[model samples]
Target: MMEVKSKGQQVSRREEILDKAARLFKQKGYVATTMREIAEQVGMEAASMYNHIRGKEELLEEICARVAETYVNQMNEIESSDLSPIHKLQALIRSHISITTKNIHWISVANNEWRHLPDSSLKSFKKARDTYEDRLAEIIRSGIDCQEVADVHVSITLYTILSSLRWIETWYKPNKSYNARDLEENIVNILMNGLKKSG
Candidate 1:
């Protein structure tokens, strides 16, 4: 028999493991972080780790999936909320950067350690990742459609934004100079308004 609680409680324990695993994977990477390391991070034993997940690959899948899923959900909801494509793009990019920064550890694994997963999980993860990028591209394309983004090279724009967000995990440190949220907003503004003088 399976036990169920409110969604929060039901998701809490697993979320704990995923969160800790994200931290470990980010710090040590997938090759270095053992299941036991994640288990210990979440206050569980090696054997007990199996109760929550099948194996490391599955854990990887969950970490990556949660990130992609969160981004997609945020984008979808915002798109449906009637925001202009330009505002939606800003909001989406801002949210994407915020979430990726908050989950830097998992984001690293999702980006760098992706090759370690078995075939099936890798495909699933790619699907989610592509969907996430496509969502952003859609917004950019919409902006072009409405003449907000101009006829710039849309693919390059999308790639630049995605790559910038992903690469920040390597250098981003919380400090007085800037935080992740501030950095995200700054990038958003720069992308919308180029460096060249408008006049």
Candidate 2:
């Protein structure tokens, strides 16, 4: 029990460091943010911060890689499910909204500051992101084939949904009138039905 408790505390501190770094990275661009600023945000000395983290680049890489991996893993699961294309699409949208809202700062940094990551990490992040987008496009293609989705440009539709979903962190306010569930439903309804009215 003592060993478990000690490990839990270590994990907690590591998470705290990442959280503070994410906020700083989002507020100030990743290049502008420093290890000292992150340490200051978490009320720790710069030297002490190193005990939990290697540096700001590692923090950015960690957040970017973690969030990217999560989206890919979620997509993998959704793709394998026996659900219809439309249902799978809805699930993807809903999951995107939910995760982004919960980790707004992390997602913001990952989306915007991922370029600052080391070359190897940058390549991996982009590959994961592209894979996720391609899987989403596959779902759209499946929908088109099954006549569930209208015959729209698959790439355009995928781009529209992915871009809009990614930008949710820019405008979504958790305690405001529009909550996650509302955002998910509204996005699905709007994207599925589109701007044109029925006759």
Q: Which candidate number maximizes lDDT?
A: 2
Tens digit of per-residue lDDT, candidate 2, span 95-145: 887778878888899888888899999999999988888888988898888
Over 82-138, each residue of candidate 1 has an lDDT whose tens digit, in order, gives 888888877777777776666667667777878887898788878877887777788
Flag regions of model 1 displaced more than 4 Å. Answer: 1-12, 195-199
lDDT values for all models: 0.74, 0.81
TM-score of 1: 0.83
Total clashing pairs for each candidate: 0, 0
Q: Alpha carbon lDDT of residue 96, candidate 2?
A: 82
Best by TM-score: 2
